[model samples]
Target chain A: MTASTQMIEEGTALEVDGLVKRFGDLTAVDGVSLTVRAGECLGLLGPNGAGKSTLIRSMVGRVRQDSGRVTVMGKAAGSTEARMALGWVPQELSIYPRITCRENLGSFGRYYGLKGQTLKDAIAWCLHWAALEEKQDDVAKTLSGGMKRRLNMAAGMLHRPKVVLFDEPTVGVDPQSRNRIFEMIEALRDAGTAIVYTTHYMEEAERLCDRIAIIDHGKIIAEGTNEELVEKTFGRRSQVLARFDGETAAIEAWAGRHGGRVKGETAEFTIEQAGEIAPLLDDATKAGLELEDLTLRRPNLESVFLHLTGRELRD
Target chain B: MIALKRDRGALVLSFVLPLAFFSIFAVIFGRQGGGTPTVKLIVVDQDQSQASAALVKGLQSESSLVVMMKPEAKSKSAPAPADYTAATAEAAVKAGDAPVALIIPAGFGQHPIAFGPDAGGSTLELLNDQSDTIAPQIVVGLLQKAAITSMPSAMADEGMKYADKYVGGFTPAQKAKVDEELDALRKAEADGKTGAGSGDSGNGNSGNGSAGAGIVAVNVRAVVGENKKSPMISFYAAAIGVMFLMFTASGSAGALLDEAESGTLERVLSTRVTMTKLLAGKLVFNTGLAFVQLTAMFLWGWSAFKLDFFSHLPGFAVMGLCTAFAVAAFGMLLASACQTRAQLGALSTLVILIMSSVGGSMFPRFLMPESMQKAGLLTINAWAIDGFTKVFWRDLPVTDLWPQVAVLLGVGVVLFLIARRVARRWEFS
Candidate 1:
């Protein structure tokens, strides 16, 4: 916990404040605020049309926000000066396929005002990092999907900016490649680069994020460390997964008495509460129920997000 | 710049294709009447001997003949008139080194006596190469005429000596008969003339026998100036230049549509690059490329077709500029209005091709029916090409081309403004 607090404070690489974008009457992004700090990986979780892409695009200057300030390295996002300090891998594999991988990196690096020896070094470094050194001379279209994904990441990081933006970089990638991407992201974080990652995969967010922001309908509904979010949402109650041989009427009476959310058939209802499994079992015995199996799960971020946003994370 | 350079295939396609077409078309179209072999001649004679001079003068008068002579060129091995043959003259002509060899055979003057009209002799020999089509005919005709004209005087002198020897006293009637016969012979010889002199007899022989009778006219120089090129070559040059300029512009304009589709244009706008700079770069590139295309095509014209392109270069340059402006503007305008690259390509190609066909890229406007020519004038290609012809083909002053130039430039300016407006809308939208 102490380490996470230190990470969060140091984690804030990109601080997006009150971000808003509108197309005519429709609001695509609305008042989304979050932080990606140094040495921390933040997962931006959302469904389709969840303003995830819009938020990322605004941060990268692909889409201009009607109102909001995105600060990268404490400077306004999309400013040449700020863009100079950040790397972005857009959701689309936005690369010129006719050109070679080395050419792609060189072009992207040039956009960051790198040239000469530095540009050359950046290209070589990226190719090595993407594990594409052997395929560097090949055209982008010839590479496999995973190789392309790796190249996309390498292109983003070519200039070695302070913060990197990955807009669903693992979409359509193989699981192995996805794992490799996570590893690379972890490696980048270990090197003190803040990463803002957006995806629809909950398990990925859960496994990879130091902190997570669950956005829906163009706004962030909940954001915190995974444990903090889960504990905060379900702290008063914990989910008790128990299988009991009992009368339906007796279980109903027990649920009514205990005042927790009871789900499933009368023989078994998982009660969400914390700190009193014994009391529950004793009460059940007094009611003449044979409790066969029981287990407890304190809520995780997935549950917290689902609870706060009222939608399944995978949905 | 690095990105642009990295896309070498695109750069090559953009620049190389037009140049290749220009080279090939230039060689084909520039050829003058399919490259038939011919020669031109200039002759100088110093010998005053009637016979010696007549031989030299005879070859000099030949049409399409290349004749050059000097005191130093007269070799000791000159062939006799009896020995001279068509094969000898043809060999000289084919060799193309020396113009024509004059072999004034020994005793050439004496042969006429045997073949005089009164003598009834059938053997009189003056040799030339009849195989050298134009030159031989002119030379032989002139030589024969000179003999006939001088022979009469010679005969009159001989008659005096003979009559003095035979008749001691002459009757007036005998002298009258002789005079009448001489006049008749003179009349007969004068009636048998040929060559270009036969058409304009007034210019050929109107109280100016010496002037008309000369084999070659002195102080003659042919000037092929501006507008003096063959109608076919002139029209083709102008039409091809205008057509290719349009193609170049349309291609660049189509690039704008590509940029828009790829969202590259939006990306560019997001940067510090402004629309004006972008448009300017495109136009400059297009215009410069068009100029290069024009120059290559004309160099072909000049080399193959005897096209006097240099004389009309100023006019061609001006016409090219106007045509380039019109095409560039029209292309950008088309791009601005079209939402996609496919639409832009199809629409611009259809419009430009139709204009080129009607306006005389495929054929000359003059060859078209009068009504079609009138219709062609409405197309910008026609106006632009016609302006070029007025300078290069009609030999008209460039000042006379202003109306067309003004119209073309006006259209270009209007189109450019419209295109700018459309591009701005697309950029923001």
Candidate 2:
């Protein structure tokens, strides 16, 4: 075990160490490691095909890692005890379409060994949490896209597991459903359930994650809180974006001296303090530069991801 | 098209499976042009007299019957003891030793088989296994022809006796005329000529009176076994019922692929349920469904066609359960082999259709060529149909159906083991 593997603490809900998975010549997930403590939500932020899904699958034991260990509540991953304490909300709609919502819940609940009144209470609570009580008798295929997404999330959490893994749980749902799902997930987090959420949406990660791990090309290049990531990537610098009207050769020269980059008619200057924007504007005015529009923007997770990976979060 | 290229299993199923089934069915029906094959007949002759020899010779002369006589070491002229007793002959027919049995009674030749109000007729017992409807009828026709040929000589001998006793006081001229007419009548009967007016030509009193009393009628006693007289309807009912049950069971079991596609299979596997429990539950449900479907078809056959379904309920029940289990396991195996629902459907349809065609569901195995009949035995459909025939048509007791039941259950066990191994990769991944 390496230092990362030894980082597993007593209250850690999930600990993955030196995980590596490969398909033929292509390594889908490189030697990546992370841990999520109880009551914490770790956002796995990455672009499509960034090995986020592969890493999460390894953690859940859906796919065997070539070399590594995933422990859930101190038990080996894929073990019965590990599976019993784990919950998974897959990216796809996993419910049986021909069956009614209640029937789908009942059948999946039985898989968790829930029975009698415990199963009954879990089902009732899931229905209320998913806001599907009114459409409980409706067939899953007949429900709107958002309702299905909600039900999918509810099904994963029905067993009241110690750890829940969500892989883009709100991929194609309505905004309202997405908000409701976030609320439910937050409630679970408050109730001491560790969550590992993977998504390409930067805003969702920024709003929901306690800590963000930006993965690229099967490797986690950065891992920290959103504020920490922003500061580390940009060093407390804010961007000043100025759009000029014409071929602004003078503005490009002034931007070069000020340690800024210019693209087409736009010039962006990275300033150390917000007050430095006044002196920059004065300098640009004296250089005979015409600014059509100017705006000051703060650095964020999106910037951190773009700076670290040299690509947009959605790319 | 790209997916098809990627999935070689699906590509093979789409093209090769249908073609293979077509080839098999074509070969089966192509060689079925020769009409009505010969039936094997077992002869148990208890009477070694000359008259019984004539009866045996008459049956042997028929082109349609292949007579199988017991080996005897005695001289031709002596009364050779019967090689097989009546009980033994019946046992041979029941055990499928022969399709038909003819038991000649001890006094068949010694006592005249008298026809008319005062004479009692002797019966030649014909035992039929009743598995094939056409074979028994052919055997019956051949036996009747043999009786017709042999009965005339005995009747003419009786006629000669009547002439000496009843016409003793007649004048020489009248007796001479009667003898001439009797000789002509015997010749006409031997020549297979029959008309009511020809015998009435001369000596009206002696001709008609002697003809009526001297004609010894032979009774053909047809002893049909437990399957009843006609077995076609019941035989077909079982065959078609089992075939359709296979289709329904396979279709239902294909839901596993659908579940996999929907990701529900992965979700379920992530829970506390083991892969073994999941597959066992599916097998049980599919088998139960198939059993109910087959039973409904059987009950329908009983109500609509009056098939003797309830008479041998135990045998039928055993066959139904075993067949359902076997078919369910087969369906699961197909599902495990294929990655998608379309592949499963195509492959299973191909297999079931070919099996049913060769195994006597669409056409009777008896009607097919000899090679095809032997090939059909390798399929589950053949064993199931044969078991059902034993219960419904042969009226065989439950104990006799063990071979078929054991074969079907054994197939189920083997298929289940293979399917379980293959399906684990699908479920756990």
DockQ of each: 0.08, 0.58
Candidate 1 segments exceeding 4 Å error:
A1-13, A38-40, A62-64, A73-76, A109-115, A157-159, A236-298, B1-230, B244-329, B354-429
Q: Write the per-residue lDDT of candidate 1 for residues B310-365, one digit (tens) a residue.
A: 87778887877887777778777887888776556656666676678768787665
Model 2 RMSD in Å is 8.3
Give me the TM-scores of chain B across the candidates: 0.47, 0.70
Q: Which ten residues in a row have the lowest lDDT in candidate 1 chain A?
A: A261-270
Best by lDDT: 2
Model 2: which docking level applies? Answer: medium
What local distance difference test score does each model get? 0.64, 0.78
Tens digit of per-residue lDDT, candidate 1, span A1-315: 453345346656788889899989989889988878787888898777888877887776666678878877766776666677678776667666788999988877765668899999999988877889999999998999998989878877877878888888888999988888888888888999988888777777887888888888898877888877776667656666666677777777876776643445322223454546788778889988787777676666666766676566667
Q: Mind giving the per-residue lDDT tens digits that candidate 2 earns over B24-49?
A: 77776654334345567788888876
